[model samples]
Target: MSAKFHWVLMVVFVCGCHAGAASIAESFTSYKLVPNIVTKAPANVISVKFPSGAVVDLGNELSKPQVALTPSVSWNAGDGLYTVIMFDPDAPSPSNPFISSFLHWLVINVQKDGIASGDTIAEYLHPYPPPFGDIHRYVFLVYQQRERLPVKDFIAYSTIGRFKFSPQDFADNFNLGDPVAGNFFRTQFNSLKTDKLF
Candidate 1:
């Protein structure tokens, strides 16, 4: 190949990699998760793939995930105990979020191998944005646990229900520190069907 053509290809390849990383950071900032939900962008990107083969991109809109096993999450983080939580910061409605940061799922002490092996404090609750409300951002955050969370704390959090649940608070209470990886997707009510195979 010509030297000029090779240079062009290299530029494209480099830019593509940068864009992939930037998209994850940009999406978190553009969605205002930086200061509201998390203090800083996670260092790693998380992949959440549902049972029907739908993957959660930065902020892509997806149909309601049907009742099924917790989506499989793949990441490059090293082996260690992890905690995964999913919540909707735009609960009720983005404009009027009387109940903000509604927790959808919480699994603690998850092994590096898989989330299913972890202790499920609270079962996964699928996205259920209000029919007339605007799109909701369902965010999943993964934290590297320093140590096993207290069993008592798990019982307390589980009893609090899903509304007004704060993942940050949970982290702080347990001293999990900031999340190391995260992912989010937007969704709204759709009665047509769920578990889309795309």
Candidate 2:
């Protein structure tokens, strides 16, 4: 077995906590997207071209492929923290109010500075891994941390049991055309203050 699995089992055993070990809240339906790894998101404008390189064809539902962010961005104060978000506009559920979004992958304090090719988000899937399931929309976000986080688990601030971490709070600064939240709405980040020192 991979060392990663052993490490996970050990953590579970040590704490005596049998958490789900995966994102059980929701899933993505559009496409298979992983965080940090660069991918192309097609333009939303009808006249604009799509990433898969096609125009929006409403007739053939499956023909119109989905597009996502390109994995990183370049901004001044904030750029190291990255998150993955998925949402389905047609899902019948509580979070989906016709615009509900499900958080698929959340990676905090990624080594934005020295990240080279061939690096996957797998290194920091401590509390959970990416969730897979029905028609879900996803967004991978990168935030600029005022300070570098020394967390091994991406969800370090996320609540597993009694205590909880409000992820919304961190990304709140960049919400709704807000400079910070809007910075990473659907873009990649580079040139963060914290240069990776590994």
Candidate 3:
């Protein structure tokens, strides 16, 4: 291949990759997830596909996830243990999320790439934004664990009320550091939602 042609192809590939990354970053910032839940936008976008063929895309407004079990989460990161946390930063109401960051799911000791075999710290709670509330952001964050989080120590996290949970504090206590990959979707209360828990 001519050197000029090879260079042109490389440029196209590079630009394509950059645009994909930029979209995720822009959406996170647009939805305020950058400053509210995470200090920085994660470098990778984690894939969250639900059983009902629904995929969670950054900043997209979704109805209920269509399943009670945790959605399938996958990421293309290094081989090692990982942790996944899903929460709502806008609990009760986005304008007044006093009980902010209501935990929806927590899985630790996740093998690289998938959450199917992970230890479940908190079973997935179907999203049910309060009837009177505005849109809510359901965020999924994947952290590369420096070491295996001791199962016994994290078991109590499930028992603790899901409300008033802090993903930042949990990461700090466990030394999980910043998330390597993340994605979020916006949802709001629908009175006609067939899956309403309340």
Candidate 4:
């Protein structure tokens, strides 16, 4: 084979491998949970790192030390404004999820990079699973917006009740098409202190 042909083949092989790896990673239950609820296919993968330097992976069990502080989130958004939402779909308890999908945090007009460049529509709420609650999935979803949304008109505050949260309804209300990126981590009941940011 010609040298140039071999080079092209190598590049294709590498890209294919990378894509395959991403596909496998996104298949985890934690990753699929968001899409299943939102009725959209997952896109970009978010990288979340806690203050203690622990990296978040699909379904990884995190305790108070791992979730006490808001983790740094980064994702690949080519351009345009975006929105970030972090919520727990297994609120109170999984078996009896009467108040499922409690909103933890919300930000609007996030730049292509991440939350740091966005407007804080809702302040961050640290994860605090009830002592008797089952393992909860805290999901972070990023959506590319058609335009800057009138979020303030919709939500008065970030710490709203868990009963009213509906990811699908939120997306439809704001015309936020399918999510551009998403990630999640699991946390169970822990004895460590859970402090409020305020």
How do the residues 6-76 of candidate 3 rate in per-residue lDDT, one tens digit apiece? 99999999998889888888988888887777777887899988887788888777786353446888888
Candidate 1 lDDT tens digits, 1-198: 899999999999999878876877888999989888888777668889998688888888877754244688877667778998888899899888888888888888888838887888777877767778788898989999998776566765565667788777877878889888888988887666544531
Error of 3 at 160 (Å): 1.6
Output the better candidate (3/4) by lDDT: 3
> Which stretches in model 4 have alpha-carbon errors above 4 Å?
1-36, 192-198
Which candidate tops lDDT? Answer: 3
| Structural similarity to truth (TM-score) of each candidate | 0.83, 0.30, 0.91, 0.83
Cα displacement (Å) at residue 79, model 2: 7.8
Lowest summed lDDT window (length 10), candidate 4: 189-198
Per residue, candidate 2 scores C-alpha lDDT tens digits across 80-101 of 4433222222223323323233
TM-score for predicted model 3 compared with the true structure: 0.91
Model 1 segments more than 4 A misplaced:
1-19, 65-69, 191-198
What C-alpha lDDT does candidate 2 achieve relative to the native structure? 0.29
Top TM-score: which candidate number? Answer: 3
lDDT of 4 at 50: 88
Decoy 4 TM-score against native? 0.83
Query: Per-residue lDDT for 103 in model 3?
Result: 87
